[model samples]
Target: MAEQLEPETILREISDLEGRIEELRQAANMPVPDLRATLDAALVELELALTALRTMGVDQANAAGRSATAETERRVLRTVFQDAPVPLFLLDRDAGVRRVNKQAAAMLGTSPGYVSGKQFIAFCDLPARAALRSQLAAVVRTGRRRRTEVRFLGREHPVDAMVTMARVWIRGEPDPMIVVAAGATAVPDGPADDERPTRTATPAAGTAGGAAREAAPLSDDRDDEVMAALVHRMDVLATASELLLDEPVFNENVAVRRCARLLTAEMTEWVFIDLTPPRAGPASAGGTGAPGAAGHEANGDLRRVVVMGQPDEHGEETVHSLEQLAPEPGTLPHTVFTTRQSALRPHVEDLDLLGVCADGQPACVKMGATSVLCVPVEDGDRCIGTITLASRGEHGPLDLLDLGVAQRLGRLLALVIRASRLYQRRDEIAVSLQASLLPQRLPQIPGVEVAGLYRAATHGIEVGGDFYDVFPAAGGGWGMVLGDVCGKGQEAAAVTAAARHGVRALSGWKSDPAEVLSMVNQALLDEERFVTAVMAGLTVGGEGMKATLASAGHPPAIVIRPDGMVRYASSGGVPLGLFEDFEVGTQVIELAAGDTLFLHSDGVLDACDMSRRQFGQERLLEVLAGHAAAPLQEMLNAVEQRLIDYCDGDLRDDVSMLAVRRQPTPLN
Candidate 1:
């Protein structure tokens, strides 16, 4: 009934069956049929032969299809895992590795096969095992994702791991599938330790068979944490940038102290800043030593450690300077000088200096410090000084390269210092000019208690454009103008002088506040310059204490009642030089007996602290309310002190406040 098969066809069938059997064996499974037995049995029973052949063909076709599908799936999985950027691993419910990608295997310094079935704890170092174990357990119990960091004992780097657990169904039964993605958080600073196995230089190539597949969704909730950390760092750098540009405090010792304290807090260590001269000896010998010092005495090699802070200390403080720390020949200073490298001096040992040195002193040293990082301060070709950071206790040794951050910080410090010095020189010139322009003292005025305070911004290099004048009007009342130009430096100062003289000269002709401001503004506008100001005329009369005010884009004066209530008389007007047709506005206020009025420059309100919070108008009113009853001088002093404190003792603009109090005539 059935046709006989050819010898060649039968041989081909046998070969195909043998190959399938071999593939099944390789996959750790067994084949179902033997080709020779099936053929021999078919020949012995002719009728049954047809039926057996039909069944055998169907069975072989099904087996062949399944084998091809399984192979394709395995290939696809391998391709997906290998191409992943983050390290990935699959583990059993017991935390035993089932499979790991190339990256994970590389990170663990082992082959995937060797890692398979091994306990996860076996790869992690002591410091990381406990945390990882806890996180893994939580993920498995909750069927959720868990994130952690692990430090492998033998590896030089640490890895951040994200683990998620899911139920994998196999043959209608559920099994645990743990997915992990790991990435290195920091680069290793040293050589690998002996405790970890060494990895091969090249990984074996995977056989090509199937298309790459997609990875499952990440379960770890680390995106927010990472982004927050980055944002916080960016903000810190921005604040630092603004602080560095501030002229007045940039070079001040206190400024440096604050910067060091900031670094200590951010980096979690103590910081020390030093400013030493380039070379040792007197200036005559081409060194920066103090004048008239002996050459052999190391005159020019001056050292000054301006700021230092220990985390254990209550607050930021200064440490020893280079001059104080200068040791005898062949000692600490000499060693540092000769070495020209950073020194790490641990608490238990003496200082070890590292770097290029003509003298044979060690470049890196450890003293009583548990950890220390030191770097030399270099400006171009010359070596200026050194900065050091130290930590005690179980924190471990310092990473010198990591301290390059401090070095970058030091460079910024140097720039601020240089700028501050230039600002100081300019200030001296401005102060001289301002002194020549202003009257030596306020003119005597009856029935009015007048006081003025001029406080320069804590950080600027030049004197501000703010200026005030108090002189008797031609008729009788007192004439005063408080004004500020739009900018800083010599040009602004020159304009300020011109405006002030113009007001004084104009008051001789015009007694009205609006007329005086109009004349001044016209003069400035004619000169094509910009300025803002407020002018006021105060007179005592039988009717009441009369005051007339005019403004050119300046803040209105605050009038404080004797009962401590304060009101602002702010009739607004355009700033000077903005337009040719600008008109100054005037308002009249009758001051009751014992009332006080305060006029101030906008710099007072613009002052901001390190946190960027402003000392606003509301705070100014509160201060005035609190000190209304005090003497004019006392009130101004208290307000100035509060402003200074609010700005954290560093002002970026000039402040001028003038106070006038109308005291009731005493009963005679």
Candidate 2:
């Protein structure tokens, strides 16, 4: 359909139009030409001249009895040759160019016609000419593709090109013609020609200064292209870094998913990330058990975490790989992970996917994948996972250049993944130390029901200083203690644990609440590790319970009557672990049936809302008055939820709440 009208046809029509215009000029006695319209028409005519030349060539080559389909195929091939990324040339069996693409013409500093019918080796530097010819000869003889790097001399200097040769058959020719493809790679400027390195392939990886292709001093234009590509890749890495940095929590799965989203934007059309689970070990403290490098031994199972691709979000790009088994040996991800290297399958087929398909993931046949690449993600020195890539866009199969891009991204993800695991491990260790310091479950006390609740600040990443314990006293009574250490983190949590443990240990010798505080305060000699606590020694009676309380710089206890009246108990003293000779103070109270006593940390009264207003004691007491008759556990739950509602973000400090209620006599 792009076969344009012949230039001669356009010229004849212009001639006929000029004759008509001349007749009009003579009849009207007008000397001025329709110059404006004529000039515009000439401009249009000039633009079509190139197409006219192409159309003329097409007409000459289009033999009679050729079907329309064959003509269309010729047009498609012509279009591809004109716009392809690399130089392409069709040569005779002797390596003389028969037809050359526009890219090849550009390289020769001439038009397509000027480049045709020339020996292909003539463009190469003298040193490479012989080697180039032999490779071409072998490819033509064996009917296989041959790859080599050649330095082709340009008008200004030489350009390094990765050249591939194969035999291509044309319908009218008896012998297959040679098809040569060349991908240009930039070479940095070297010392004035005398110091130039020998033109031979360097490294087999990256396009820049790599063994996969020979090197030569390049022009400034070539240098610019290479520099721009390096910058582009750096930009991709920077973008991925910014995305991960945006999150407060450097979660492992979140990092992988974000990487998949970013890579799908450019790196790969589809990405399948398979992460190996952390090796099994005892949690250091309170961890979610994500393994760190110290526990990097995996059972060799990689669970697919993210699947993303093009055109559609749900279809083709999606994989239900959670139902699949671990990657088996010889599969794409497995081979890459085990070998600790990348694998590029330039062309993929259903037969190559027998193991992949059986593993609950959609096969290449379903996703329409044309090529695959697998790169392993490393954490520290161990490979943590493999990122399998599937590409199906115009970018074609994965090349050495593409592999470089994937490798850089994998390295970035590995660093972040390892850091996230370490952070979680440290957090868990702190939580475990804090947990072991407290009772596993509340001790049941006669005639009283107790419930306690605790929450660490800082999104559970750090241990809170809050602590609580319930244990039996020496004289057939029970003791309950709640305390909060100054500051937070591992150090503060250690002191809080020590304080709770000391109280439980000393409760065996002492039944007095004040004496328990006095002994624990002496043990906490670190001025840096002081605590404010409220201790209670309870003696249960037949119908009610009497509790003697000791306050060590903690908030006063509040009592809620069955009729909803609320009152604060006498609880005020110098906080323990600060002064060497501070007096231990105690307050006694007897609670009737259906009454409750509430003890709390200062985090409640000092908690700030969005408006920066503290939830003061009056408001807390007012709220307690309303929950006076609620069950002990229900009261504790409601109180916690209320505090959470008041804080806009995470709690600013650790919170601990303890409640003691005298259960009503059994109904008869």
> Whose lDDT is greatest here?
2
| Tens digits of lDDT, candidate 1, 1-668 | 22234456456545633432332222221111233333332332332334435534332235355456546645555677667765677766556787887667655444578667776655553223323443554344334465555544222233333333342312221333566666555434432343221111222222111221232232243344335434644555566667666543445465566666766655434555555432321231232334232222233353445434442232221132222343234543344434556564322122232221223212211111234565555433344455666543222233333355556665566555544444455556667776655567776566778888887766555657888889877687788888888787777778888989888888887899788777677777755558888888988875358889998889988899988999999768887766877788688989987799789999899999889999999999998999888898899888899988888888878888887777787777
Which residue ranges in model 2 land beyond 4 Å of their true spot? 1-232, 282-298, 311-318, 321-326, 344-355, 359-362, 395-402, 526-528
Across 226-283, the per-residue lDDT of candidate 2 in tens digits comes to 5654665667778988976666767877888899998777566778788776544444
- Pick out the ten consecutive residues of candidate 1 with the lowest summed lDDT: 360-369
Error of 1 at 280 (Å): 18
Question: Judged by lDDT against the true structure, how good is candidate 1?
Answer: 0.58
lDDT of each: 0.58, 0.67
Query: In model 1, which regions exceed 4 Å deviation?
Result: 1-274, 277-301, 304-323, 327-376, 387-444, 454-463, 488-490, 526-529, 541-544, 564-572, 602-628, 634-655
